[model samples]
Target: MWSQLTKKSVWFIGILFLSLNAYAGHHGMKKDIVDVAAGNENFSTLVAAVKAAGLVDTLKGDGPFTVFAPTNDAFAKLPEGTVEMLLKPENKDKLVAILTYHVVAGKVMAADVVKLSQAETVQGGTAMIKVMDGRVMIDNATVTGTDIKASNGVIHVIDTVLMPK
Candidate 1:
């Protein structure tokens, strides 16, 4: 019964995704990093956190930035209550640090990402990179999608949310 409900939910979500695309704000043309995430249902959790952290305007601003955005499912993988705790007003600084850790100063496409071994994040930490079986891994998270262009920068989807030291 549980499995059946889960399957039905997945099917509903798939249909919703298709409908969402028709009204997506990010579309084929110009959209900033914030817009790109906001327009994508997969990144809804990320968008909420960005807004909560007060980094929405910074990400929406001009100049290239590369963001390895973790999907909603990725956020869900964190310890229970972790997301709720991070969303608290008192945890703003900590949340900002974690979010910034996912961003790089310049736009790095998938092609360029593969050639490098590591890259520094905006949070003043380095993200370790490794390639195994022709797949790029950042820290322990694999890059799922790359070079999702935005007016201000680019976004690459990752399977895990990176934590900053």
Candidate 2:
């Protein structure tokens, strides 16, 4: 009887551990696009720009948005003072336009992205999509990473910041 009780207790503990792990995994995957971006160090510039442009709430909303997120290095590649200028309150409109240019209306996965020649942006400009030398390009920015799942959408990392013409 003692051995049987011990086995039962062990089984119960094992099930509880598994259950807790599963819940954690699910919770981890539930972060929205903005939250995911903010959690990553590489997206610091992008996150700050979004906050400066007052786009944090919009990006955090229930959007199935596909974001071509540029890294801090990408922002650094811009002409000197460009990011600083855009972050100014007076340039909010331009900043919003530029940021929205990187986002699409829906959760478009990498597989679907490669099939498109161009995608219409939330900024009302169209971004030309091309696959050259086996690398995907959205406008002039090359997609370095793809299909980072968020609760509301997906993120694709880009090596350059996209500008609307």
Candidate 3:
């Protein structure tokens, strides 16, 4: 009877270990940049933009893309009509341009970003990065969170939405 009890205890402990491991790995991004945006509550506008641009699948693809995701509060920083205007069908191209501006081709971490003067965005141009006094600034936005790991890419949360010139 003692042997049987020991076996049961061992099995219970094994199951407990597996459960803890699963929970620890829960926030790991599996669907790449798109999934990062989808899973984050602050990035609802970004998710919607990806869906609108029909780039959800592409962003979810096996690309080590780096995305500077903006929160809904970031979108609100735009002019009163800006968000509404961009959402209109007539502004699809413009919206796509702005959204793409936030993406960089490779997985760049905040530590690496501070060393570069500028990095090319997926929007076809480069953005200036400034690191001073331990604060990392990307153009007009401030880096709120860094090195958020995802399955296909990495995510950095920004306080303001970036716009192309």
Model 2 — which ten-residue stretch has the worst lDDT?
Answer: 24-33
Q: Model 1 has how many clashing residue pairs?
A: 0
lDDT of 2 at 41: 98
Clashes of each: 0, 0, 1
Number of the candidate with higher lDDT, 1 or 2 = 2
Candidate 3 collision pairs: 29-151
Q: How would you encode candidate 2's per-residue C-alpha lDDT over 16-77 as one tens digit per residue?
A: 99999899797765889999999999999999999999999999898889999999999999
TM-score for predicted model 1 compared with the true structure: 0.82
Model 1, 102: alpha-carbon shift in Å? 0.1
Candidate 3 lDDT, 1-165, residue by residue in tens: 999999999999999999887976785524567766788788888788778777788788887889888889999898898888887788889988988898999899888988988889999978889987888888988988999888887899899989998
Q: C-alpha displacement of 80 in model 3, angstroms?
A: 0.5
Best candidate (score: TM-score)? 2
Better candidate number, 1 or 3, judged by TM-score: 1
**How high is each candidate's TM-score?**
0.82, 0.85, 0.81
Q: Which candidate is the best by lDDT?
A: 2
Clashing pairs in 2: none
Which window of ten consecutive residues has the lowest lDDT sum in model 3? 27-36
Clashes of 3: 1
Compose the digit string of candidate 1's lDDT tens values, residues 1-165.
999999999999999997788657546447899998999999999999999999998998876899999999999999999999999999999999999999999989999999889999999999998899988999989999999999888999999999986
Prediction RMSDs, each to the true structure: 11.5, 3.6, 4.3
